[model samples]
Target: MNSDWLAGGRAELAAERILDAVRTVFIDHGVSGVGMTEVAEAAGCSRATLYRYFENRQALYVAFAGRETRALIERIWRDREVSVDRSPAQQLLDQLTAVLAEVRKTPHLAVWFEPANAGIVAQLANSPGVVDALAANFVARFRPGLSAPAAGRVGRWVVRAVVSLLTLPGSNEDEERAMLRTFVLPFVLDEHTVID
Candidate 1:
């Protein structure tokens, strides 16, 4: 979206344009490095206009993450194949790995997990907001029978695991997969094992 579209009665479009600009800026400068002023210039708008859309950098980050999470979920499920032959563990592996792969592949999203920026992510996640909602929604697809609260517990656990691996990966993808299979899968994939 071009800056010309940032006029009256187009608040949503203007916000999206700002976010698009932020994504580009994030690829060059890690999430922590991006500033509201830089985003304004990138979006071809004044700092006042940028602030009108997003009160602050944190607000912008939340909006971007919220928009992208829904889109990411769609992409993840679009490529997913459900087969009776596939074991539950394998399915969980595929789901988790797909998330890790997608996050790593997306420059804007990956920047959040960069070691220096991971702390910012952690700070945002401590509150029961986007992170909790994202994790719950992601896990609920696999454990549809679990209640909201139960799913939340499992989801928080999954987010922590993902963040840990993203910030400090194991030796390689193979090793990371092995660790997830051993430590993370059973609890999340096995309904018999209660998560309290």
Candidate 2:
């Protein structure tokens, strides 16, 4: 029951509350339109308190993106219904496709994919520690022989491709899947990896 521990717990809760407010605001106002003042108002906290939790709008957005990315990764792994016998390439395709579907299904996360907000989302997506970790982890799990740097590169590429598709979707899901198989798999998977 230390005072410092209590303060720390309160701070963490406040930060989470602020993020929840951000989710609401982002969905209502769009990621590009929301600012610190708006977030503070939505969170029922002063601008100073909001700043103490998140230094700037970009910082808050990055934090939100990081949180969503982790959730998306967990959901993908959890909901995976593919058989163990599937090839690594096939599994990766399913995983990436699920990622796109999940983002589209989540309103706050989907807003970032809108043309106006996509640049910001892309910036965060390409950042080293954000979605890259999730992507690299997925790749490493499916293709365990890949080196860390190589897996990381594939991870970044997967993020970039997902962002691209989100920004400018293909004719349909069928076309998108075909594109991933033809363009993405060849580069992401090992040369020896078969895609049956």
Shift of residue 7 alpha carbon in model 1, Å? 3.1
lDDT by residue (tens digit), candidate 2, 67-138: 878988898899996687998788878988888888888898889888898678777876668777778887
Clashes in each model (backbone N, CA, C under 3 Å)? 0, 0
Candidate 2 ranges beyond 4 A from true positions = 1-9, 191-196
Worst 10 residues of 2 by lDDT: 1-10
Model 1 lDDT per residue over 1-196, tens place:
2556557787678888888888899898888988998898899888888888789888888888778876886788778877689887888788788888898898888888888897788866565666677688777777888889988988888888987888887888899899899998888878898765
Q: Residue 15 CA error for candidate 2 (Å)?
A: 1.6
TM, every model? 0.88, 0.88
| Per-model CA lDDT versus the true structure | 0.82, 0.82
Q: What residue pairs are clashing in model 2?
A: none
Model 1 ranges with Cα > 4 A deviation: 1-5
